[model samples]
Target: MIDFLTAGLVLGCSAGFSPGPLLMLVISETLTHGTRSGVRVALSPIITDFPIIAATLLLLMNLSGYHGILGGLSLAGGLFVLYTGYHSLTARPVQLDLPKEPPKSLRKGVLTNLLSPHPYLFWITVGAPLLTRSLKVGPAAFVAFIGSFYLCLVGAKIVLALAVGRSRAFMGSRAYLWIMRLLGALLTFFALLLFREGLKLLGVG
Candidate 1:
């Protein structure tokens, strides 16, 4: 259970650090709608992810009859996390093509990730099993699991938004190279760990 909590937290941090369509929207909101909207974007995941986790867990419970399939799905989920982390570390910021306002753009960003297949895939494969396995340790253990998972998942992003939004004084003086690069390195480690966990599911590790 400790191992599961640790791994989920690591993977959650990796995912949160990476900027995506939603993140881009958050930035746009920060620029146009002000820092508050970006902060809302941080909280939006709370609205989305908990239900996602629940729905995903229910589905996985139904599919529990097939261990091999479950294992394969876990491997796939792990690989997807690895890919997203790699993409995050290397990702170039999206260039704005159309001149648009922030609110609409932010809404779009929120919708994109929420509607994307990736979140469902991750929860279905990796998160559900990690959670279900933790639950067998009892309810308190499960609550700890939930608490630990979000502490990294949601908390990391909120801190990130706050840091970037608040960096006015230090902006341009330091390029934020060190911290960004350090996150990239951590992301890489996170990717490998997910791969390892996936392999464990497949009985390959």
Candidate 2:
């Protein structure tokens, strides 16, 4: 339970803070509309991720008996995480150009997330496998993992919305860069761990 919770928190925070299209949207909304708008954007994953997760979990369940396939998926997940971390390490300050349109924070966010490949890839390769394992431990453990994940995920973005609202320059600040770099370092560590897990599943480590 503790392990799952910790894993969820780390992954959630990394996902939340990671520089991506969704995050850019959050900042754009905040700068263009207001903190509330950005916050609505942050809450999007809560609305979008579950369906992706469900679909991925169903797909993985069919292949659950195959260790080789699961190992391969874990390796893929590690590579993906490594790629994400590399981007974070090389992150640059976003140029916030306000959209010349009305504010539809939640709708835009939902559409963006729904159309993005990241969530699908993450769930298929990493999230579903973790969820499958958690179910073996118990429903409570599964809930803990997912609950903590979204809690930190949405919470971090909400905090970012608040920060950006307070200081428009917050997105391009040295503090933001350092924080992302730190998360990148942590993500690298997690990626290595994923690789180890993959190897173990493959009976190579």
User: How high is the CA lDDT of each candidate model?
Assistant: 0.63, 0.87
Q: Return the top candidate by TM-score.
A: 2
C-alpha-based local distance difference test score of model 1: 0.63
What C-alpha lDDT does candidate 2 achieve relative to the native structure? 0.87
Task: Show the colliding residue pairs in model 2.
Answer: none
Q: Model 2 off-target regions past 4 Å?
A: none
Q: What's the C-alpha lDDT at position 66 in model 2? A: 89
lDDT tens readout by residue for model 1, 1-205: 2366666666666556555556555655665566776667766666677788998888877876776777777667667766665665565534432236646543565676698776777788677777776777777666766777677766766665665577533212233334344556665665566567656656788
lDDT at 20, model 2:
75
